[model samples]
Target: MSGSAQVRAWQPGLDGVVEVLHAYFPSHAYPSHTHDAWTILLVDEGVVRYDLDHREHGLTRAQVSLLPPNVPHDGRSVRPEGFRKRVLYLEPDRLGADLIGAAVDQPELLDPVLRRRIEQLHGVLADGREPLEAESRLTLIEQRLRQHLRRQVVRPAAHRDAGVAGRLREVLDAHLPGGITLDEASKLVHADPAYLVRAFSREYGIPPHRYLTGRRVDLARRQLLAGRPAAEVATLAGFYDQSHLTRHFRRMLGVTPSRFARS
Candidate 1:
């Protein structure tokens, strides 16, 4: 995956119990991993093959999936179109931590009520606003996510091994403008290079190298969108050459960096 990182995260309210995220995986997969918070997803387009526990569950357009906290899982694309989904996060303490551990056997499916709430959530989140309208929508979504958690006994544990994964997050955030080798990042997380590879694949469903490359591409896109020269943005985004950047850009984003920049 290349072109630019388009993943975004935000906390929209004063409650602090909820967070929202939007991600576009053009040709990437998240390896097996768990989140510290609950993940409630609304599949907007394409398909996502979610590997939860030991079984693979395929979610297509309009399907809703709920992932309880600390549940080992990974994601894969079920088709060539790739997948795009919106995810909501709610904390365990707010959800009553013991609730999820009890329902580990049977998780709830997204019903119509939850589905409608998800649509509203997506509208507010995607708009990227801070007005009362956005805040009100955010609150509605937060309440709904928590309500689902209580009903399903799901707690927020969306990321895999929060303590260990936090280290990786730190490195990723630090090197977002460039790119980091999985080997080098492994040192920071205190995991062996090979193990890091396996773990990232298992937890996130994508290889670490691909993830880094995608992130670099994402950063380059942002710079280019701001009117930076392609050659200059390429180096700043950790590409060795513009051709290297261009090849990946077309492959992942389905357009040249210049074209995307114009958008």
Candidate 2:
């Protein structure tokens, strides 16, 4: 395996995806191990050999691998050059208990749609400014995975929950700078977390998280124009810090917050 300098890991802002990893292994083998979260793995170069539930498997660029939680597994490069990979360690409950069996039976998936989606997800995760997009992509990915596991069509969410969507939006508005978690939002609105996301998206034409971000940006703009410093406006406007506000501000308005205020 490569040195620690060659590997990077972090916890992202999204609740569904707990950790992100990018690593290269030059010549290392992993011992059997278990994780409390599901591992969504993609290999960018070389081949990886792995063991899950005492069965052998291989991962390559042509596939996306989903390893279920609490399952014993090990992995290593089959070639001397080893493998370079990106991984998202998702929360265990995101996939649920029923799908674990299907994963054990078929951990290696050869779906081009899934591979592309995972690649896109990793891109946004790296940017670290698109939590809303990340959550939406993850929702669809889970849908496809459940379809694979159940071997049946998982219907897309209906647009019949306008009332629920409207109420949830109000609740989100109430939560503000200290935004509510997905679980809390669902509980307050009396809906499933996934259903809440789907309903809000269908009714508003944007994800809940995006709506919140827009609101925060709006607040920042108002405060900035009032002559508040960028650093101070950051927290007052619900952003984590100045850089966080600057990233979203530049992305949404095509200029940095300071420049926007000058304009």
Candidate 3:
């Protein structure tokens, strides 16, 4: 391991995300290992030389690489300085098994759009506040990845589902503090989960989860101003707990619930 190596890993609240890792290794070599989830990697510094299916590949700054689940792979820095990388370990089903062969054959992609979107998705995932946003981004990224694997042209979907979007919004509003899962919303709205997310985001300025969080924050403010304790206000606002409420509240309002209440 490199003496200067630093790593941060966490499982985000997003259901589609298995885990996220950001690491820097000055000098380390990875032994062969296989993951149950897809490894989506972005190298930000230096270079990574990794072997997938016994073939060596180089991941550089310009590419987003996807290592298929259950593929044995190993990595080490191309230089003495090692490499810095951010990774998203996604659910195995995020991409179908049929594409595994394609991914294994060409794990590194030169698509700038995919790289940018993956970076943005990482940003959304890191916040841990916008599950809907993260899911939406993830869905599109997965779609693009599939297209790449299948050698199809990467293009935007021309269809819109305003009817499904409107119904999903109603479900979200009705569920409120209880909240609903994307799967649940999809089943209830009778639409594909990916379509539900894309449509909701387009119909409303914000994604459903963020919209719900905003509504919860609004309710929280009202309760705080009414002199309720932060803890109680959290429950009343539909947040999981005080800390949960604080995360979104502070992000939206720029102050903690306690501070807001005191003021």
What C-alpha lDDT do the candidate models reach, one value each? 0.65, 0.79, 0.79
Compared with the true structure, what per-residue lDDT tens digits does model 2 show for residues 54-133? 78999999999999875667788888787888988888899897777788888989999999998998889889998899
Give the lDDT of residue 45 in candidate 3: 92
lDDT tens per residue, model 1, 37-155? 67777777777886776667877665567677656666777777676767776665555556565335444454677688677766766675745666576567656655655565444
Residue 198 error, candidate 1, Å: 4.2
lDDT of 3 by residue, 164-206 (tens): 7769867977887778899998898888998888887765435
What is the Å distance of residue 107 in model 3 from its true position? 0.4
| lDDT score of residue 106 within candidate 3 | 83
* RMSD per model, one decimal: 7.5, 14.6, 15.1
Model 3 scores what on Cα lDDT? 0.79
Q: Estimate each model's TM-score.
A: 0.53, 0.57, 0.57
Overlapping backbone residue pairs in candidate 2 total: 2
